[model samples]
Target chain A: MFKATVNITLRDSILDPQGKATHHALQNLGLNQISKVRIGKLVELNIDADTEEEARSIAEDACTQLLANAVVEDYEITIHKKQTVS
Target chain B: MSTTFGIIVFPGSNCDHDAFYALDEVMGMETKFIWHKDTDLSGIDVIVIPGGFSYGDYLRSGAIARFSPIMNEVEKAANEGVPIIGICNGFQILLEANLLPGAMMHNQQLRFVCKNVFIRCETTDSIFTRGLNKDQVLDIPVSHGEGNYFISEDGLKELQDHDQIAFRYCDEHGELTPEANFNGSVDHIAGILNRKGNILGLMPHPERAVEPLLGSSDGRIFFESLLNRVVGA
Candidate 1:
C-alpha cells in the first residue's frame, strides 16, 4: 500500500478572498513582516500499487481528474511508501 | 412543435423545481426532472442545469456534480445541437465539466449577495436571448456567494473577439459602470455563451422572476423568448 498527498491552491493570478481575510487578521495582530498569504487544500489518497513511481502517477491522475480544478487551481502530488509489520 | 425540457436534478439541487415551473407551467413547455444517475435524454429538446448548491456545493460549486452519469448524455446532446442553459450553480458545473471556459470565485465583497440585478443583453444571435436586442437591459435576481467569474486575459480576448459574451452586469439604466458590476466579474460578465452559442451559463436566476407577483417579471420574458426560439425552430 502507498499513500499520496495532494496540495491544491488557487492560481496566483486569481484573487484569494479567504487568504486576504486571514492576512488582514494577522496584520491586526501585529504580524507586519509577512509579505503575502495564500490558502490551499490538502487531499490524501491510499493506493494499492507495487512501486513508488506507480503510486505517484496514480496520485497525479487523481489530482488532475478530481482533487484539483485546472482552471482555478494548481496541485502537487507526493507519495509515501507504507511500511508493513511482519 | 413544443419544446420539451429536461431539468437535471443533482442531489441537493434546490432549483430543480423552480426550473420545471418556469419551463413547464409558465412557458407551457413539457418538462421532466432527470435524475443525476440517468443518462438517457431521448425526446428532450433542451436541458437545464438549475441553480442551488448541488452536492452541497462540495469540492467547489459544481465540481462533483459534473461527474454525474447524466453528464455524458448531456455532452452528447450538446454536440447534437440541443440547447442547454445552466443557471447559477448549473453554470458553475458547466465550467467544471469543461463545457465552458473560466471559473467562478467568491464574490468580491465576500458575502452571499441576493438581490435584483440589471444585465444588458450582449448578443441576440443565441437561442436564449433571441428576442432581446443588444444593450437591452433586464432586471433579474442574483443570489450567490461564488459568482465572481474569472478567465485568463487571452481567453477573455477570444470570447470578446467571437462575441461569445451573452450578458453583462449593468446599472438599472443600462450603464456599464463599476457600481453596476455586483460580482466584480472580469469585463462585468454576468453570463457567457459557448463558441457555438448552443450553450449558455448565467449567474442570474431568471426563473425567480417569471411572474409579476414575484418582484419582477422581466425574467419571464427572458425564458419566454428562449422557448420561442426553440419552438420556432
Candidate 2:
C-alpha cells in the first residue's frame, strides 16, 4: 500500500482573498518580513498498488479528476510507503 | 408544445424549492425535482441547477456535487442543445463539471455577501438572455461566499471573441465599475455562457427575484426567455 499527498494551491494569476486576509492578520502580529501569503489544500490518499509508480499514477488521476481544479488551482503529489502497525 | 423544467436537487440544495415556486407556481409551467442520484433526464426541456450548499459545500462549493450521477445526464443533455441555467451554487457546479469555463473563488471581502445587485445583460444571443436587450440591467439577488469568478487571460479573450459573456456586474445605471463588483470577478463577470451558448452559469439567484414580493421582478425575464425558447419552438 502507498500513501499519496497532494498539495493544491491557487494559480499564481488567481487572487486568493482568504490568503490575503490571513496575511493581514500575520502582519498585525509583527510578521512584517513575510513577502507574500497564499493558501492551498492538502489531500491525502491511500492506494493499493503493485509499485510506487502505480500508486503515484493513481494519485495523479485523483488530482486531475477531482482533488484539484485545473482552472484556478495547481497541485503537486508525493508518494510514500504506508507504514503498517503490528 | 409543452415545456418541462427540471431542477436538480443535490443533498444540501436549499434553493430547489425557490426555483420550483418560480417556474411552477409563478410561471405556470411544469417543473420537476431531479434527485442528484438519478441518472434519467428524459422529459426535462430545460434544466435548472438551483443555488444551495450542495454536499455541505465541503472541500469546495460544487466540487463533490459535480461527481453526482445526475451530472452525467446533465452533460449529455447539454451536448444535445438542451438549455441549462445554473444559478449561484449551481453556477459553481457547472464550472466544477467543466460544462462552463473558469472557476469560482471566495468573495473579495472574504464574507458571504447577500444583497441585491445589478447585472447588465451582455448578450442577447443565448436562450437565457434573449428576452432582455443588450445592456439591459436586472436587479437580482446574490447570496454566496465564493462567487468570485476567475479565468485565464487567454480564456477570457476567447469568451470575448465568441460573445459567450452573458452578464456583467454593473452599477444601477449599467456602468461597469469597481464598486459594483461585489465579488471581484474578472471583468466584473456575473455570469457566462458556454461556447455553444446552451448553458449559462451565473452567481446571482434569478429565481429568488422573479416576483415583486421578492424585492424585484427583473429576474422573471430569464424564465420567460427560456419558456419562450422552448415552448415557442
Candidate 3:
C-alpha cells in the first residue's frame, strides 16, 4: 500500500490575501527576515496500489480532476510506502 | 410570449428566492426552482444561478457546487448558446464549471465588503446590457468576501480582445479608480460575459436591488433589459 500526499498552493501569479495578512502579523512580531509568505493546502490519500507509479497516477488524477483548481493552484505529490503489520 | 426562468437551488443558497421574486412576481415571468440534484433543464429558456454560500463554501467558493448534477445540463445549455446568468456565488460556480473564465479570490482587504457600489457598463454588445448605453453607470449592491476576480495575463488579454468585459467597478461619476475597486479585482472588473456573450457572471446582487424598498431599483432595469432581449427575440 502507498500513501500519497498532495500539497496545493496558489500559483505564484495569484495573490494570497490570507497569507499576506499572516505575513504582516509575523512582521509585527519582529520577523523581519521573512521575505514573503504564501498559503496552500495539503491533501493525503491512501491507495492500495502495488507500485508507487500506480499510486502517483491515481493521486495526479484526483488533483487535476477535483483536489486542485488548475487556474489558481498547483499541486505536488509525494508517495510513501506503508508497512504491513500481520 | 412568455419566458420561463429556472433558478437553480443549491444547498445553502440563500438568494434563490430573491431571484424568484424578481422574475416570477415583479416581472411576471414563469420562474421554476431547479433543485441541485436534478439534471433536467428542458423547457427552461433562461437559467439564473443565484448567490449565497453553497456547500458551506468548503474547499473554495463554488468548488463543490460545480459538480452538482444539474450543472451537467447547465453546461449543455451553455454550449447550445442559451442565455445564463450567475450572480454572486453563482458567478463563482460558473467559473468553477468553466462556463466562464478566471477565478475569484479573497478580497484584497482581507474582509467581506457589503455595500452599495456603482458599476459602469463596459460594453453594450451583450444581451444583458442591450438596454443600457455604453459606459452607463448602474448602482448595485455587492455582498461577498471572495469577490476579487483574478485571471492570468494571457487570459486577461483574451477577455480584453473579445470585449467580454460587461461591467467595471467605478465611482458614482463612472470613473475607474483604486478606491472604487473595493474588492481589488483586476482591471476593476465587476461583471464579465463569455466569448459567445451568452453567459454573464457578476458578483453584485441584482435581485436584491430589484425593489426600491430594498434600495436601488437599477437592478430592476437590469432584469428588464434581459427580459426585453429574451422576449423580444
Candidate 4:
C-alpha cells in the first residue's frame, strides 16, 4: 500500500474571494497583522499498487480527472512507500 | 423545432428553477435538469451553469463544484463549441472550469450586493447576443458577494484587443458610467465571451427578470437572442 498527499490551490493569477473574506474576518477579530491569505484543499489517499511508479500514476490521474481543476487551481502529489512488518 | 438545453444543478444551486423557467416559459425551449453527479452530456445543445452556493460555498465558491462529475461533460461540450452560459455563481464556476478568463473576487467593500444595474452590450457577434446592437443598455439584476473581476493588465488588454468583452456597465444613454459598475470591475466589465464567442459568463441574473412582474422585462432580450440563434441554426 502506498500513501499520497495532494495539495490544491488557486492559480496565482486568479482572484481568491474566500481567502479575501477570511482575511477580513481575521482582521475583524483583531488579527490585523496578517497581510495576505490564500486558501486551498488538502487530500490524502492510500493506494494499493504493485510499485511506487504505479501508485504515483494513479494519484496523478485522480488529481487531474477528479480532484483538482487545472484551470484556476494547481495540485501537487507526494507519495510515500509503506514499510512491511517483519 | 424545439431545441434541448440542459441546466446543471449542483447541491446548493438556487437558480436552476429560474433558468428552467426562463428557457421553457419565456423562450419556449426544451429544458432538462442534470444533476451534478452525472457525467453524461449527451443530446444537449446548450448547457447552463446556474448560480448558487455549490457545495455550501466550501473551499471556494465553485472549487468543489468544479470537481463534480457533470463538469467533465460540461468541459467536453465547451470544447465542441456548444453554447454555454454561466450566471452569477455560475460565472465563478466557469472561471474555475477555465471556460472563461479571469476570476471573481469579493466586492471591494466586502459585502453581498443585490441590486439592479445597467449593462452595455459590447459585442453582438456572440451566440448569446447575436442580434443585439453594440452599446445597447440592458437593465439586469446582480446579486453576489464575489462579483469583482480581476485580470492582469496584459490579459485585460488582450480581452480588449480581441473584443472578448461582451458587456460593460452603462447608463440609459449607453454611456460608460461608474454608477452602474457595481463591483468595481476593471474597465466596468460585467460580462465576457470566450475566445470562440460561444461561451459566456456574466454576473447578472437575466433569468430573474424575464417578466414584467419581476419589476423589469429588459432581460427578456437575452433569452430571445439565444432562442433565435438556436432556431435559426
Task: Give the per-residue lDDT of model 1 (tens digit) for B33-141.
Answer: 9999997999999999999999998889999999999999999988998999999999999999989999999998788999999999999989889988889999999
Candidates 1 and 4, the one with greater TM-score = 1
TM-score of chain B of each: 0.98, 0.98, 0.99, 0.97
Write one digit per residue (lDDT tens) for candidate 4, span B1-233.
56899999999999999999998888778899999999888988899999989988775678689878889889988999999999988888998778888867667666799888889899988888887888878988988988888776877998999989999977778888667666778888889999988899999999999999997787898888877887788
- lDDT minimum window of 10 residues, candidate 4 chain B: B102-111
CA-only RMSD, every prediction? 1.3, 1.1, 1.3, 4.0
Residue pairs with clashing backbones, model 1: none
Q: Write the per-residue lDDT of candidate 2 for residues B58-122, one digit (tens) a residue.
A: 98899999999999999999999999999999999999999999999999898899999999999
A1-86 per-residue lDDT for model 1 (tens digits): 88788889999888998899989999999999986999999888888888899888888888888778888899988887684623
- True-contact fraction per candidate equals 0.50, 0.81, 0.50, 0.19
Better of 2 and 4 by TM-score: 2
Give me the runs in candidate 4 sitting further than 4 Å from their true place: A1-86
Q: Candidates' DockQ values?
A: 0.71, 0.85, 0.72, 0.21
lDDT of 3: 0.93
Q: Which stretches of candidate 2 lie over 4 Å from their true place?
A: none
Instruction: Encode model 3's per-residue lDDT on A1-86: one tens digit a residue.
Output: 78889999999988888899999999999998998999999988888887889999999998987888898899999998774633
| Candidate 2 local lDDT, A1-86, one digit each (tens) | 88888999999877888899999999999999997999999988878888889998999899889888898889999998765633
Off by over 4 Å in 3: A83-86
